[model samples]
Target: MVDFQERDTKRGLREDQEAAHEGPAAEGDGAADEGAPPPGDGEAEIDEVRQQLEERPESDGGQKAHPDESAADPGDDGDHDDHGHEDHGHDHHHHEHDLDELGAAVVTVSSSRTLADDPSGDHVVEALVDAGHDVVTRELIPDDYDDVQHTVDSLVRRSDVDVVVTTGGTGVTPDDRTPEAVRPLFEKELPGFGELFRRYSYGEIGTRVVGTRATAGIIDGVPVFCFPGSTDAVQLGVEEIVVEEAPHLAGLAQRDADEE
Candidate 1:
């Protein structure tokens, strides 16, 4: 009986020890499993998506912006880009100054059209006034080269005129001598104005745009913009180019005059 009791006690102790060891091992395994990440977690997938978006090229069916788009965006910080367009290289904001209130003169170089009949001239005056610019003088001069020259010279010399816009005498005809009359008086010619005008005109009139001699320049301290006699041409020049850029141009012209 004594041997049997001793054996029973030994067996009980072994069993209790085994149970205690197994309990802790089982609990540890459960805790490790609970703490481990699930198979195929979203972090890897998210990383893959970000990598794809970052690596995708614009030519690979991705929408790309214009070269000057960053500079054009008002929200963009004009930082020095690897593409070579420096922040200080271009002042896309030049138009925001000096053009708020301008004193302009309108010269209609049409022998046949009076102020009552001059639609283009009227358009110029109205557009300028609508933009809050003052039209100091409006003259309907003959298409003669000397008269056009004299009128423009007189207008530029006036204290009230910051800009002079002439409509008519810019076509490829016998009387289309606006360029000839105006070129001599210009201290600096804005060739880009004619180039951009012709480019925009080409979209409307196609190949025939080559015949028009639309031009812009600085005469004394005033910016002179010459346009065609047709109402459509006048509107195109005013709306697309002059109205948008003249203030900036006038400011630059005045600055140049001040520096000189």
Candidate 2:
């Protein structure tokens, strides 16, 4: 009876050990079955995300998926390029109307000078001629206001004269009357001429440039520029300013004649 009891006790301990090992394995299996997703759940989620991306607008995230469809059309690119060229052309079209050669008149206004002694007028004529312009007529007149006005007025009315350049009587002295005499005849006053002249002259003459009354205007479709009497000043005005701008000014001033 004692031997039988010992065998039964040994079997009982062996069964208890097996139960402990199987208990943990069975709980692990239950966790996997209850907590894990279905077999096709991951694929279904991937499909749903792909469908949402496909349905998105091109302006949104869809552009990254299809690069060719998002590229600029070739015809649209050509139109943009053509529009840029047209804008560039329009900006420079006025250059075509500028004159290649023009007629000019030179006048010197001084109380103590003649054509033989007029260095400023000489410079004006030489510069204009050098720049391929014709000096239609040159005159030396006294500093009288009426003389200056009448001389410039008569010159501007001539069909052969496209521009008039005068030297002298453009100072602040008591006899200075070029601006006074010539301003009333102007149909349009070019204030920029005097402003730029003084600005450029300021480097050479300092504040003394303020005494200069150099001026310009449009009179009877002709551009008239009045410069100071000094040879240096006239040289600067002619070479630096007049020669550079006169052709364009002359062309635009005669636009009415061209239209007619």
Candidate 3:
């Protein structure tokens, strides 16, 4: 019986030791859990990082979308033109007329320059022809006011002549009568022509443009441009102003006639 009692005591002590060991083990596990982040903390941190990456701009090399490039619109190849215009149509075109060519006559008015000696007149003809218009006739008339008047009158009356260009006598001098000769014949004065000529001439001759008497007007449904006798003046007038405006001017001049 004493032996039995000793066995029972040893068993109780062993069981108690085992219970103590198990309790400490559970407490150690709780302590380990305290060192770790709270529930959902790790997963929430990962989600926050993902959200930040999504919110960043694509320009910053992030997963965010580009402003110009859209995946929803499959036609967006990333080409954007700032100058896109409403439908391409001829009716809404800035320039009203579509005339491609015209018939032009060149008249040189100078006491000394015969048809053979007229460099300014020759330039006028060449420029007109090169711009896709036909120089149907050319004349070298003296600076006499009556002669200039008659020649321009005859040219404008011709059905084949769409425009008459006179070179010479377009100065403030006493012999300068081309503007005087031509001014009386205009049905309508194109004030802008003289203004633009002087503006462009100012670039070449500087302040000396003050003396230029260059002028233009429409007569009997024909456009007439009068230029100075100098080669430089003729060049600026023909190439810069006249060549670009001739077709449009001719179209506008003949519009009433065409309508009638």
Candidate 4:
């Protein structure tokens, strides 16, 4: 797969980032209970998320979403992505005119080493566009924990953005802390998301796919899905995961996110 910095440039975010939580999670829920990270949500939990959003150089006052400094490579074989999966189909199949009442965003994360022409990043943008949803913004941030957490909290708190599709940081490595970073902000973790993602990817790629740490959960009533750094992983994550389920999930999340 291409490096993380490379992916961020192509995979941008969706609009409506300004709307803060208007429904339940932000207002309905009582104080969040302290607990261990979700099932597969690993260690380095809180620290990694905070690290990513610290500061942006050159911009001085403009601390926009910072891209990763180093390029990202999953280290696993990238060849599997060459072939499309069997269960794959365009996610716009059942939506009402592609713009299904919800707004979305795409944020790619990595070290500062990303480049232009990122394949997976481009793929994410294309899929969201095809689905007819309004894509508002795109950003890059370092693989720091704080950055990831900030991004999640920022998007989720926004009332307009119904979902946030995040790529990278979903692994078990020392730096693979997507779950750890975002889990804390989640009022509830979507365990089935992790299981279903692994199952879907497994059928297509087989068991050699343990490196990914895919997950889904709610952050202040906003649905968030995190995927591995691979283009194939991102493909499956968005097409099979986000586009297909985002609408219903968004409504349910607003209503019963506590059960996510």
| Alpha-carbon RMSD of each model | 17.9, 13.0, 12.7, 45.7
Question: How much lDDT does candidate 4 score?
Answer: 0.71
> How high is the lDDT of residue 28 in model 1?
40
Q: What is the lDDT of residue 149 in candidate 4?
A: 89
Top candidate when judged by TM-score against the true structure: 2
Instruction: Encode model 4's per-residue lDDT on 1-260: one tens digit a residue.
Output: 22444433333221112122222234665654233123333324334544554532455465644665554577956566755565335543433333255677778888843537456667787888887777676666778899998988888777678888888888777887778898888887899988888988997789867777788888777788888878988888788878888877777667544445
Q: Per-residue lDDT for 17-74 in model 2, tens only?
A: 7656555446446443333345666557667767887886666543455555666666
Report lDDT (CA) for all predictions.
0.83, 0.86, 0.85, 0.71
Scored by lDDT, the top model is: 2
TM-score of each: 0.64, 0.70, 0.66, 0.58
Clashing pairs in model 2?
none
Better model by lDDT: candidate 2 vs candidate 4: 2
Using lDDT, rank the candidates from best to worst. Answer: 2, 3, 1, 4
Residue ranges of candidate 1 with Cα displaced over 4 Å: 1-97, 256-260
Q: What C-alpha lDDT, on a 0 to 100 scale, does residue 11 get in candidate 1?
A: 59
- Give the higher-TM-score candidate: 1 or 3: 3
